[model samples]
Target: MDERELRNCFGKFPTGVTIVSWFDGSVQKGITVNSFTSVSLDPPLALVSIHKEAKACTGMKDKAFTINILSDEQESIAWQFAGSKQEILEIDWDNKGISPKINGSVAWMECKPWREYDAGDHVLFVGEIQELHFEDLEALTFYQGKMGSAKQLVK
Candidate 1:
């Protein structure tokens, strides 16, 4: 299949939105990513795939990063980090004394890089979860190039 077909097929699967934040001195850099997942429970490992062209990709090396899992109410926050805006001054953000985190997110996971692999169009960053937090809110989801909420799939 062509690249367009491949992307379309990939988009068929829905995924949660997350903001991966890292520190550049006092300044914080973050990017919205849907390509994130748990790798292992015993080691508490997770991974995020970032495009080679992303500016935030290079800044993450050897630095602590926080994955702020967006709630359904955080579509604007996701769009902000997704590069929809030239500036994200309106978003409520804090460093949480560890790493940058978006306020009011459903969950947050602070991690340190464990490994990085070159994956052609993207780099896969594996991280060891350092800290985590959760709130009682529904998560935001991305599917077919649009934002929405996850619907429970009861079997």
Candidate 2:
């Protein structure tokens, strides 16, 4: 199987960008992900697929986490977490919650670990949402390996 080709094929679908943040002892850690999705409403469960090799994959196990859905203005933040940029950007975090959330996200969900599944190259983490927040701002999105705003893609 051609991994690059498979990734390209998967990239055809648009996905909302997110920063999955968690605490590693006293330090905060996060990773860029576009594979977040709501798994259930009655149980208020959400899921994030993280590559097995990512630090966040192990750091978040059995830990509280926040899925910070990026706003359209947060492209640089995504790059920073994705390890594509060298310069570290100063990010403001809302630390009042069980897990700190990135400020200025279009939406955020604070969650507790629920379950984990071993997928091929990634691990699927199911989180039970304990709290959430949202704003009426445009979301950052990924499609065809490019980043853009939800509004920009709709047009």
Candidate 3:
């Protein structure tokens, strides 16, 4: 039972990078998340897994939030929210939606908390997508512990 090896194995799979943004009463907060996924089409549900200690998840329970799908050019923005970089993010915001949308993102979804569950060291926040915005841009990705540049694959 090698946890490090297991994490490496999980990292081998490519995943899209996203920023989960929420307001914590006093200020806006965001965190870079790679565990976001679509759960259902009929109900328009999505999920984002956040570590129990994430600063962004401080006051997110039962609240509205935004999931910003980052473009490859937004790697720096991701790093900023990830707390892996020192530079503060100076991004634009769209206040038209139920939540604040990150401007210049490849896509975004305003969501409301639908459900939550415990998952070992993380909590899974299932959100019901209320509205969305998107563009045809390459998405930022991660694989094998490295940031990846992935272009949109047309179907």
Candidate 4:
């Protein structure tokens, strides 16, 4: 199998969209990430995997980061961060937590750095969830190389 074939196969799995954000001393840095998940509720842990070359990865060295679960209406915000160059974050950022978080997201998890691992070209940044909040809004998701919205089907 080739790279595109692998990526296409990976795209088949639906993933929630999250903006992994952190502060690099003086400024905020972040990236659009679909690679985030809850690790363990016992310890209240979670993970957000970012590319090794992403600024947010290196900037997170000794700081805190936030996992902002994007809502369906925040598709434009996703595109803005995932764009080629780091577009200046023009959104209202809330500082009531460990790291800067976007306003109006479906949910937010403020985490302190827990651990990190090398996962191929990505750096898995695990965090201990220090604070969390959620709303009843729908979530943004990615699947089959497209962005979409998802609502809890069982609830």
True-structure RMSD, every candidate: 2.6, 1.4, 2.9, 3.1
Deviating ranges (above 4 Å) for candidate 1: 86-89, 151-155
lDDT of 3 by residue, 44-108 (tens): 99999999987656568778999999999898888888887756657787766567788899999
User: Highest lDDT: which candidate?
Assistant: 2
For candidate 1, which ten residues in a row score worst on lDDT?
146-155
**In candidate 4, what are the lDDT values of residues 10-103, reduced to their tens digit?**
9878888898887766576778999898999989999988888876777787678899999988887888878745356467788766798998
In model 2, what are the clashing residue pairs, if there are any?
none
Worst 10 residues of 2 by lDDT: 146-155
Positional deviation of 134 in candidate 1, in angstroms?
0.5
Model 1, span 35-57: residue lDDT tens:
99999998999999999998887
CA RMSD (A), model 1: 2.6
Residue 59 lDDT, candidate 4, scale 0-100:
76
TM-scores, each model vs. reference? 0.91, 0.94, 0.91, 0.89
Give the candidate order by descending lDDT: 2, 1, 3, 4
Error of 3 at 59 (Å): 2.4
Stronger candidate by lDDT (2 vs 4): 2
**Candidate 3 ranges with C-alpha deviation above 4 Å:** 151-155
| Pairs in steric clash, model 3 | none
lDDT of the candidates, in the order given: 0.87, 0.92, 0.85, 0.84
Clashing pairs in 1: none
The list of candidate 2 runs beyond 4 A from truth reads 86-88, 153-155
